[model samples]
Target: MTSNFLIFDCDGVLADTERDGHLPAFNETFEHFGAPIRWSQDDYAELLRIGGGKERLASVLTPELVKEAGLPTDPRQQRDVVLSWHAYKTARYTDMVRAGRLPGRPGVARIVAEAHDAGWGLAVASTSAEESVRAVLEHVVGPELSTHFSVFAGDDVAAKKPAPDIYQLALAQLGASSTSAIVIEDSHVGLTAALAAGLVTVVTQSSYTADEDFSGAALVVSSLGDYPADPTVVLDSPHGTAIVGHVGIDDLIRVRAAALSANSTPGR
Candidate 1:
């Protein structure tokens, strides 16, 4: 069966916005609030395991960091502080998008144009804030493609990636069944979310997520594709070759075909 909708996770998949975009925005927010918490690339690479911004912050807060930062030791107050920081970080992240500091991932424009022309429904389901996601989408696909997408993002639901709530919401809102949707992700968390929702997923490893596991993805790749200026390079792996450029509808159709075939076979 062919996937009727292509679902995207924003941060690493649509844009290589983490190092140049998100990390600096987060540090700027921490500075503005006079907080001692500043996440370096190395620090955030570890935190990426946690899935949500506020959740990641909560994970690292110890009695010592709280005391040193003059934060309340109580769990509720800690939650509030993390939420406040995330709100500020989101604003700064959006500001960076507005300033054009972040560029969409290579081949994003080409693939989106191809999909749009083929009449495929497009949507972005991400843990990132809606404003930030929409900004990046606009930058990548222009206003027309941006407007065509149904966005389900931050805080609209109770749980983040690896929980399937966001993807579930996107599927419901878009009236797409799991079998009829394909998700594009960069992290294991996002991959887990899509798989749990019973949708096939494709992974494009980003800098922060390259070493993470992607056992269940239908396809795992280095990037979507390279353009004229940038050559496409596929990574060889023990499992298979990682897709890189101009991966078309037929490629995705093959993935679904393989998945269906694998499922229908009797036990050995």
Candidate 2:
């Protein structure tokens, strides 16, 4: 029998790790290296638009930032510095995870449990470091669930989100076709990546991704919901409000069905 698969993005989707994990880690790395740079929440929010950590750092190497930060003008030197920063930032982020400072987003553990019980194949596709992704998986879903997932993360593929490389790699690794799988994403970049891979996607807004556009998502929600707490989170947007219940295998199945129907329709 064929199996259904669900692909999830790390960072925002699994947890609000950007604020608690990434941003702080990056800042700490900067301070450690005496780079004279710090990313406030707003600053990091803008930097989040960039796909990669190194890319985001490289973006600030402008004349103004160079003047302000006293950075090297040589392109190769700048690249090396950015790589070093990212490496250190990754280590700091992993330390935060190891210390159990970052918690899973509401409903993440429950949803993963439900999906696993229903025999869904699980995978994570992320631009973050593989170790970071693994740490999150272990934290949110526990070691058993973590062991079950096929993780495709940073440096595993040539390109990052909004390009579909990671998602495409997940599909290939899982031996599943796009139609047989669904993706869960928080950022517009992640949603774009999943949709571009011809997979149905569901959006669960996180702290930093609440304002992102999710035009192609099968459903856009504020969260997956918490059992014994709330069963759904109503998503508010200019379009209207959408009530998304705590996501389960059924929700993913429905999303795949809708995508199949949409694909079948002409001019859709």
Candidate 3:
């Protein structure tokens, strides 16, 4: 018998962690570290284009910016400095999660429970630190459901999203084929990674990714939609798969099948 896997991307997908959670944590970390740097919402939105937190922080490092910010000059020292900042940011982010400052996405708990009941193999693939990822996952899905998730995050893979390395690593660790799993991602970067790895993907747009292109996704929704209060809004479905009302287990199965069909094409 074949087993199915549900791979979730933390942060935006699991919880609206970018604007509320990560952005604030990053700004606070910089303040705490005495680096006269603070990422405005606009700046951080652009920074999200970079995959990892440390990578995002490092992207602003130029000769002028480094000197202006009084950051370390030596290459090794610069790297260490970035690592330290990232460590502090992760700690701050974890604290925010524990404090329930970041709430899970609309349908996170509903879908997680549904998926769990169906015996799906669950996992979280993220560019964030492991502790942060685990904390968010536990908060979103509760302790029991979170335990069912195999988390692969933060330096676990040499490359991050849009690289396919992390997704590949998750597939390997889960001992599951790319076709047997479906990825729930919020950004084009994560979509690109999942697609490159031959996995089906359902994109739930987040604050930072609303305008980003997700041309290859099987289905795109505003949120997963827990029902009554928050309903899943279908943004795009290239395969013509119908998403009646909120997206539920049936919708996911159909989306996965559509992806499988799309991927099974000749030379594709």
Candidate 4:
């Protein structure tokens, strides 16, 4: 018997964690460490383009800021500093998650339940730290559902989203070709990575990624849509797969089929 896999991105895709969960944690960590910077909503929105919390922090390491923060000028020593800050940030982020400060995004729990019932493989592919990802996953789907997830996050791959390393690693870990996997991503960066790995993808535009380009996605929706309460809105379907209801296992299967058909066709 053949198997299909559903891989999710943690931050914005699982829940709207970027704005509510991570952003504040970063600011709080900055305050605690007496760092000279705090990422406002606008600043963090731009930072989301870069994958990984450590990379986000590393990106803004200017000589002036380093000096202000008393950070080491040596590359390796500087890395140690960032690592400590990231560890603290992860703690704060998890605390917020444990506190139930963020709600699961529409359709996540419902689709996860549907997928589980159908015997689909489940996993989370993310640029966040593993602890942080696990915390959010548990909050989104509860402990029972989260246990089904195989998480690939943080340094699981040398490179992050927009580079394809993480998604490629996921496919390799499954020992399966990209044909058997589908990725659900919220950011263009994550979408690019999935496409680069030759995986089918659906985009659920999140708070920070709503205005970004998602030209290659097989399907794009506002959310997975929990029937009766939150309806899924189709934003774009490049392959023209019909999404009549909340995106479920059946809809994802159709999207994957349509993508395979399109790719197999000649003369583009």
Per-residue lDDT tens digits for candidate 1, residues 116-165, read: 88888999998888888999999877888899888999888888888999
Question: Once model 4 is optimally superposed onto the true structure by TM-score, how far is the C-alpha of residue 38 displaced, in angstroms?
Answer: 1.4
Q: Give candidate 4's total backbone clashes.
A: 0
Candidate 3 CA-lDDT value: 0.90
- How high is the lDDT of residue 252 in model 2? 61
Residue clash pairs of candidate 1: 224-244, 225-244, 225-245
**lDDT, model 2, position 163:** 92
Candidate 2 error regions (>4 Å): 63-71, 236-245
lDDT of 3 by residue, 129-190 (tens): 99999999888889888888899999998888889999999999899998789999999889
Q: Could you give candidate 4's per-residue lDDT for residues 1-268 as a string of tens digits?
A: 3388899999888999999999999999999988889888899989988888999988878999988878889999888988998999999999999999999999999999988888888999998999999999999999999999889999998888899999888888876679998999998899999999999999999999999999889999999998778889999988888787689899999999999899889987
lDDT rank order: 4, 3, 2, 1
Query: Residues 1-268, candidate 2, lDDT per residue (tens digit)?
Result: 4488878899888988998889999889889988778899999998998887777878877888777877888889888888898899998998898889998887788888887888888899998988899989998899988998999988787777789988888888899999888888999999898989998888889899887888878887777878557675656332232345566677667667866787788996
lDDT of each: 0.80, 0.83, 0.90, 0.91
How many backbone clashes are present in model 1?
3
TM-score of each: 0.90, 0.91, 0.96, 0.97
- Show where candidate 3 strays beyond 4 Å: 265-268
Ranking by TM-score: 4, 3, 2, 1
User: CA shift at 156, candidate 3, in angstroms?
Assistant: 0.7
- The predicted structure with the larger lDDT, 2 or 4, is 4
Q: Pick the candidate with the highest lDDT.
A: 4
lDDT of 4 at 250: 90
